[model samples]
Target: MPIERLADLANPATTPRIVFKVGSALLFGAGGVPDREWLASLVAEIAAAHARGQQVIIVSSGAIALGSARLGFAKGGRGSLADAQASAAVGQIALAGLWSDLLATHGIVAAQLLLTLEDLEDRRRYLNASATLGRLLQAGAVPVINENDSVATQEIRFGDNDRLAARVAQAASAQAVVLLSDVDGLYDRHPSEPGASLLEQVKGVTADVHAMASGTSGSGMGSGGMTSKLQAAEIATRAGITLAIANGTHASPLARALGEEIGTLFTPVRRDGARKAWLGGRLRMKGLLVVDDGCARALARGGSLLASGIVEVEGDFRRGDPVIVRDQAGGQLAQGLSEYDAAEIDRIRGARSNQQEELLGYAPRSAVIHRDQLVLL
Candidate 1:
């Protein structure tokens, strides 16, 4: 959908699309309940952005905490898996209701989506979710996403919303992401430690940056910390998306941070295309496809990896699996989505397109890794 207008209220650098991530600590105000007044201010900011034709998506935490409060127990409850799930189950309702009501105050609808880590890992499911978020924005609804803790097993959960927010930014093709937590931004060390200083702008998330990270939040309601925010920066930067770590405890967090640049901003590294960003952002690789020097040259020229150029297919990868492209010297060159399974690629490796169908006894698809599916490393 086309943006109808643009204004200063929207984030100047990334106005068209942005994701705002609110952590539980900020959502859980005094007395273990949502600070309705604070939330109302944030919602008003969102409404203003919507009016400016800046699409906004929210990744919010606090369901489990809300649920725990409703269960009339400590947020941890018994600290068991069942207890956690029960809290999330009850809290999701209240949390969703709160968001709906707050957003509805401005005639905006809040569309809730609960996603597990597995959903973003699978291509089919990821595409489905990406499309759904797009449609929601076109329909003028703000997408309020949260990790699917209610039914997700520990193995399939995100554990923290920081990285989840980055994944949602990638999925939504957001131009920027703002992580709203208790602290204003990332510090050189634990914020309370003597001499600790806030880093205003991070060019990249390096080892030194990781060294600066602190542990999980001291606030009992939160799971993410500076370490996870750095991890999130790594994910978002690769996708060419700008990310900010900002304080959300007060009202109008977006206006304060985005307008005043009052946060730690991580800039984008590449801006070629969203598809390439997705490939660059992907963390999983099913296998490696080693190519001849000729194939490597072709890939550099923006050509696909035809079977004829493949010298080796390593791993038991299935069709459409993500794989790294390597040169003859074992130097990583690119990563792409493989069109053929490992067994099939092995059979057809070094074979020209004409010979592919003859050897496999079936008509073959195009490139082993199409150019559109590949990104230079």
Candidate 2:
């Protein structure tokens, strides 16, 4: 199908679930904090979609902008990491309040969900987050999600909400992810330069897109640019979610993009199950697990790994590190984070958790690798 046709199909009028990401540059002007009139119009468009019975989840970026204003920092200050984190702490409340008040005006109830990379990285937490968001959609509530910046260290941060939005779209099985940015759409060259032309439709994210992108221009409100947007497009497309990069400066940009009258649409190459997509597209992994023959066969047959099947555990991976699930023959069957540490798994292997204390003097929860946590390749 043509990219525009795919985009038309993914519109809220045709599709049930949709995820929208609003960038900081679009949310706030050159100054900090949200533009009230702009936000009101944006909320109204989202409310219109809700009235049409389509589920919408918003991944918003503006906490730092709000925080910078609150802290009296200039837009392009060379603040330390701690300074940025502090600003997020102060700005989160003001940001949520804006959404709450704006949505309330349209008779739409909005809920705030603050997430860290850790939340999506751990299987149990990932399932919980997915279920919660799904329930909100079912209940006709729009979930406004943001990275938990106040507490998240550099090690656990999503870096920018564009990528976080893609992860949310995967979690929701969203038909599309609309990225609202300052620029209208992807351009053949830097939009700032003369003669740069906007590309209306992308068949898929290609090397050309990557080559054309430039990193953040030190605008300082948030740390994302054309490059990050393209990275986000790749993430969303590979997960089978269509993505549109549109200018959020215009009020109701999302509505315009959905109508296929505005923005650059990037068509998806393929789609996968929500959980499977999340598992496959993780940014990094923490450890490795080597299993025996029986485990490999069971996994191939769509069965879960049992404690009796594991042979060796490598590295100092904690309970939630993304581990390579390898067979005794050294072939990989799947990749999942272990639910237990290397030491714990080593002690509990080939035996039930109930038998742990009897053999090793201590017992933890059963099932070193829970079925829900395992994503087969």
Q: Which candidate has the highest TM-score of all? A: 1
Q: Which lDDT value does model 1 have at 159?
A: 83
Please give, for residues 244-341, the per-residue lDDT of candidate 2 as tens digits: 88877776776665564567888877665666678765755677777778778887787766667778877888887777788877765677657777
Task: Please identify model 1 stretches exceeding 4 Å from their true place.
Answer: 1-9, 12-14, 73-78, 283-319, 323-377
Question: With candidate 2 superimposed using the best TM-score fit, by how many Å does residue 86's alpha carbon deviate from the native?
Answer: 2.1
Q: Go through the candidates in order and give each one's C-alpha lDDT.
A: 0.83, 0.77
- lDDT assessment of candidate 2: 0.77
Best by lDDT: 1
TM-score of 1: 0.77
Total residue pair clashes for candidate 1? 0
Which regions in candidate 2 have their CA more than 4 angstroms from the true location?
A: 1-10, 74-78, 287-320, 323-377
Model 2: lowest-lDDT 10 consecutive positions: 1-10
